[model samples]
Every structure is written in C-alpha cells, then in structure tokens.
Target: MPPRCQNILLLGGSGLIGRYVAEDLRLRGFTVTAIARRYVASQRTSADDIEMPIMTMTADQLTHLMLDRKIQMVINCLGVLQDGPGMDTMAVHRDFTAKLLAAINAAAQPIQFVHISIPSAADSDHTAFSKTKRDAERLIAEAGIGSTILRPGFVIAPAAYGGSAVVRALAALPVADLPSDLASRQFQPVAVDDIAGTIAWLCEHGDHTHHVWDLMQPEPVTLGAVVDCYRTFYGTDRSTRIRLPGFLLDLGAKLGDATARLGWTPPVRSTAIAELRRGVTGDPAPWIAATGIVPQTLAQMVNRRSATIQDKWFARLFLLKPVIFVSLVLFWIASGFIALFISYDAAAGILSAHHFPTALVGPITVGTSLMDMATGALIALRRTSSIGLIWGILASLGYMFGAAVLTPDLWIEPLGALVKTGPAIILMLAALMTLDNR
Candidate 1:
C-alpha cells in the first residue's frame, strides 16, 4: 500500500462515496484534493484536515489542473443516469473514463487512476450500459494507464447520500417496486461507508496493473425482503408491489443501454436499472472471489430507527412546492406585463385591439399551458421529450413579434413573454423527468 495514499485527487469528491472516501483518506494521513463540478467555497468537510483545495472545473479544466497541481492519485467517482444526450451510458461508463485515463497519463507526475464501475458490466452485449462500461474498460486498458476499476453493487448511504431526501421519499411512498418472486432473487446491498472503506483499502495498497474489483455485500436478499427492511425501519406504509415482467424490463434495460450509447440520459441509467433487476436474479460469487474483502450486508449498514416527516425541516414547508410554483407563475405574469410595455403591446395593437391583448399574452399563456402538455406527452410515449420541449420553448417565445415592434423595456422584461428562462428550462426538465426510461 505504499504506507498510505499521501496525495489523492478525487474527481467526484462532492458525491456520496467521494465525501466519505475523502474523509477516510484524510483520517489515514493522506493529503486529498477533492475535485467536483459543484465545489463551493463555503462547503467544508472533516476530510479537509490537510487543508487541500476542492478544485471545481469542467472535464477539460481538470486536465490542466492535474498537471499544474501535481496530483498523485486520480479517483474518478463521476456518475450519471440519463441526465443529457451525451451523458448517457456510453459517456458515463466509457467516454468519461477514457478522458480521465488520458489526462492522468498526460500529467507531470505519474498519476494512478481509480474508477467506480458496476458488476456484470463488461459484456459487450450485456445491455447498453454494460457495453459502454466495457468500452470504457477497454479504452483504459488500451491506454496502458495505471488504473483500478471498482464495480460495486447498490450502495446504501441514507445519512451520507442525503439521509434527508432519500428518507423522506421512501417514507412517503407505498407499494415500492420489487422483482416478481423477489423473495427468491439474491442481492448484496453494501453501505456507502463500506465502499469508502474499500477505497481506503485500495489507495493504501497502491496495487497497480489494470484491475477490476466487484465491491459487494456478504449476504443477498430479495427485493421484497429489502422492502420489508425499509418498512420495518421507517414504519413506512407498505407499498403496492408491482414487478415488471423480466422480458419487458430486460427490453427496457437494453433500450436504455442503447440510448445511453447514443448519448441520451436523464432517464434512469440502463446499468443501474439492470443492477436493480440483477439484484433480484444474479449471483455474486465471481465478485466475492475477486475482492477478498467481505462486504457488509444490507442489515449491517441501514439505520432503521423510527422517524417522522418533521425530521426534515424543509418538508415542514409542505407549501414550498406550491409556493415555488405560484412564484413561478407570478414571475411570468410580471414578466409578461413588462414585455407588454416594451414590445408585445405594440404588436398586439397591430394585430387588432382584441387580437393584441390575447395574442400578446398568447405566448405566455401557451408557454405555461405547454409545460403540462409536454410533461404528459413525454411520459405517455418514448423519446418524444425533445420535440415536446422544442414546442414548449417556441410557445414560450410567442412575444417575439410584439417585442420586436414594441421596443422592449430592458429594465422590466427584456422580451415580451420572456423574462427569466429558468422556468421554461425547468418545464423542459419536467418533460425530461417524465421519461422514466427504466
């Protein structure tokens, strides 16, 4: 283990595993620099005992930072599940890994790379996600970089991962999804803490030679059993159990995998979905043999103490969602009037007094209306989110004609029906969210 991981660079240090691992490394006398896309100056963790900077930058920016900073170990904890066109399976599992390996090799100090992958993801045709993950592995091997890939099963970190968000969501939901006859399917859910332990183990070992580790739990359980544990923990209402047919889910897994390879995401990552399916089907023997480390079972890791909604201070404002929505609408209303003063009002007069007011507000109204429609349309069908979002954005821009004629009042609303683009963007996000490509 080279005594200890003295200087480590964490790519996804802001994430669940990243935070824990960074903390553990610092505790072990390692100097750690956590790299994240969302690094905040105000955010601090016990892991920073060594006073290492949390460098925030894009993928390209990271290449420069690595050389300039003289980083030793490059740990890529980057992960994604259908967040964008290029961020799909292929990108997350393969392309991103390839880039990291490339940059690490180019660094002034010889960099050792560590990556988090999933099990049964090496098969070229296992699923879209597996294929791309395998692609990433192949690329890393081809580059001949000093790297280690750890493919772990579902990591349960209630407290670290957002004990708040996950607990609240799980608390409210009933009839959680499970595999059919899950009572028999095997699973090995490990804790985020254990995963952090494993990272520490790997860093201390400093074993080089392109390798893969399947970080899994000692015992396996069925989906129903996992749900039972959750039920016992939160006293959460028993959820209606619905299991998708294996073939259907398998098909979805394959489709999702394909979409990811083509750079489509924001839906569930095909790999994770596949893992959920395997959680109820596959064996972890090969994984067990590869990593001598015995993983903790689901029971060993979860803190099932009783709790209530009151625990989450934010939920108390049960009114926040509604208030945010109302504020959003009012924002549009005010922005619309501002638009009226600048451009749309003149265009409306040109359209005819009756047409002017209605038409001027046409884009604003249509834009708001389209938000719901696009969300539904995407949920009802497959891969229609792009079209729905395009139409919605066009609808939101109905004031173009008016703004051009009226001369927009930049102080109020720069455009007729448009003031801030976040809502329109968020509305499109709603449509994207509706596609549960699981």
Candidate 2:
C-alpha cells in the first residue's frame, strides 16, 4: 500500500537485540541509522552508527533528526528491566514512547514504528517494569500512527545479556539448584533471529498496521526445561540438580535490588524476579499467520550452533562478576581500615623507619588510607567502578614502586605484603576488563 519503507532509524543499537537487528537489516539492503548512548571499542563510529542519548532528546529534536535523516521507519529497541542509576522504568517504557509517538505524528513524511515489547501476562502490572511497558503499548495504539508492536517471549539470542545471561550462568554452574515453584513455571522462548526476521519482513512489505503480535514458539516449556536445554548445549545436562528453598531466591532478589541502586543491573533484581515468577507466555498464532514465520523450537534455537569456548567462559563468569566486585570492595576497605585505625601506629612506623619526616607520617598515613577507602567505595558502585578500578591499579602500582625504593626489604618480608600487591593489581585489571554490562 505505502511506498516501500527505507532509510530506517534504530534506537538502542548497542543492545543485545538492537545490535543483531541493526546488522541484519543492513545485510538485507536497508539504510539503517543505529543510535546508542555509547559504543564499545569494537564498534567504530560512523554515519550508520551514531552515539546519542535518546532519553534526553525532546520530541521536536527527534522529529528534526528523523526528517534530516529522511527516516521512513523507526525501530525502537530501547528498554530497561528495572529502575537504577540513570535507568527509570517509566521514563524509558512510557514517557519515551509518548515522545516518540508525538515525533512520528509531527514528521512531514510518514514513519513506520516498530516497537519491541514484552509478552503480556495476567499480572502485567505486578512490577513497574511490566506496568510501564503496558502503558507504552496503550499509548502506541492510541497514537493514530502506522505502528507494529511486537511482544516477544523469553528471547534466546546467541549473545547473552540480562535474563538470558543469568540463565546461561545457572546452566553452567556445577550444580543446578532452583526453587521448585520457579523451576516449574512456564517460560516460552523466542529466538532473536525470529524477531529480526519479523522486522525484516515488515521492512520488505511496508505493512504498518496498528497490530500487537506475540512472537515466540507455539509450544510451552518450563523454566527448568529451558535451563536444561542450555545445559545440554554446554554438555553438562548430567550434572546434579537440587530444589532450592523459596527464601534463598527471595534473598537473592533483595541483594539484586540493593546492587541495582549502586548502578549495577543484575539479572536477578526484584523486578526481574517478579516478572520471572509471572513467567513468559503469549499466543504466537496470530503473528505466525500474519508473518508466515514458523518459529524455531527451544531445541532448534539452542542447537543451531555448537557452543564456543567464549560462550562457555561467559556463562561461567556471569555469576562470578558479583563475587569479584564484593571481594575487591572488602579487600580495599579492610586494608584502609587496618591502616587508619587498627594498625595506625604500625602503618606510620613503616614510613618512619624508612627515614620519612616525622611531621609527614600521620598526614601521609591518613591521606593514603582515606584514598584506599574512597577507591573501595567507588568500586562498590557500578557507575564509577571502572574509574575505581583504574585508581586502584594506579595506587597499587605506586605502592609497589614506593616500597621498592624505600622499603625494598618489605618485598621479601615474611608476610610478603608487597608481593601480594601484584596479584591484587592483576585482579583489579581483570575487573576493569569485564566492567561493561551491555
């Protein structure tokens, strides 16, 4: 009906779904302009890949950008699972959607809006995440724009992120223990490629009906069965598994909430757990009939390709991230605490014995101890963890060099305190390397 849509604009281009969809669309001969808040080193900046914070932009600005780029289609992949530092559920899922709809209406040329949303459940309003999502869907339906809202079930992508990463980590664990109730809950998964394929189909056909379609496998599967599929892929299906108590899962959710406030987006947050309890389900018959896409089963998705070493490493390290951060936080804070209070005299004595000025000893000891404590605090927060790790590495290096020059004998001390600094520095470097959550 409408002229074949072209010149697309994709939001959240650096995300798990956004990245794959952007690449897929480009390969299919669409002029796609991908936008993200930030890009990794591997993704070079160019006209196609533009880094901009869409949340801060107004509708007028978005309209102007769309007009300037001559965008005929807008695919919004931007979404947040919970509220955290700079991550508001309402702002992202509802307010932004409203602005985007207004922008679409304002544009001189018509634009096809493709929004990626979660599958609806009876208890969709149980959490802020789902509530705002439903709010957005309603806004889109009422916007009077040619739009297609796709509600995808648990997405099984080659690249793991958010909930999928947690699933992989659980499968990779030596023992697979899950709460009995949660283990049996329904979890209908859709392949990421299917979502991409659907979008490509829309792009090719120029169909922008105001229709909300559920994209997932027809058959249902349990949460435990989904994990078992990953376990089978990882060749660990025979591992021992036990049913964990409900309280442990509750505790984990609480911990996840606590970490979220600190700027970390853990997959096990309270909102995430709430949504998980509700489980992922949807009727894909309408979508399949409309798009003529035969969705892949869980086995087909998992066994599409053999697991790689990198995939295994990521799965194993997914859970270890929190452990690494916690250890670093305690390590730095304890070191500072001992130096400042528990062993203040001993800390000052080290410098004094090396002929450090009497007047400078206390100030130096107090200042460095405070610096150590500050570094620990920074590392504890996700927003500043990278900066904190850099500072820690620098401080550790300074300590090593200063000790080598003034307290060389400390290197060979019975405690080997200086020798231990090397490993700590190495650990900090490792944390820095794995800092990015996207």
Q: For model 2, what is the error of residue 207's alpha carbon versus the real structure, in angstroms, after optimal superposition?
A: 2.9
Tens-digit per-residue lDDT, 151-177, candidate 1: 766567644232223323333455435
- Candidates in order have lDDT scores of 0.56, 0.89
Query: What's the lDDT for residue 100 in model 1?
Result: 72
TM-score of each: 0.59, 0.95
Q: Which candidate comes out best when scored by TM-score?
A: 2
Q: Write the per-residue lDDT of candidate 2 for residues 1-438, one digit (tens) a residue.
A: 433777899999999999989988887778899999998867644468988988999999999999999999999999998887889989999999999999999996779999999896645568888899998999999988889999999999888888899999999887757788888989899999999999988887746569889999999999989998999999888888776788888898899989888978788878888888888999999999988999999999999889999999999998898889999999999999999999999999989999999999999999999999999999998878999999999999999999888889998999888999999998898888888876
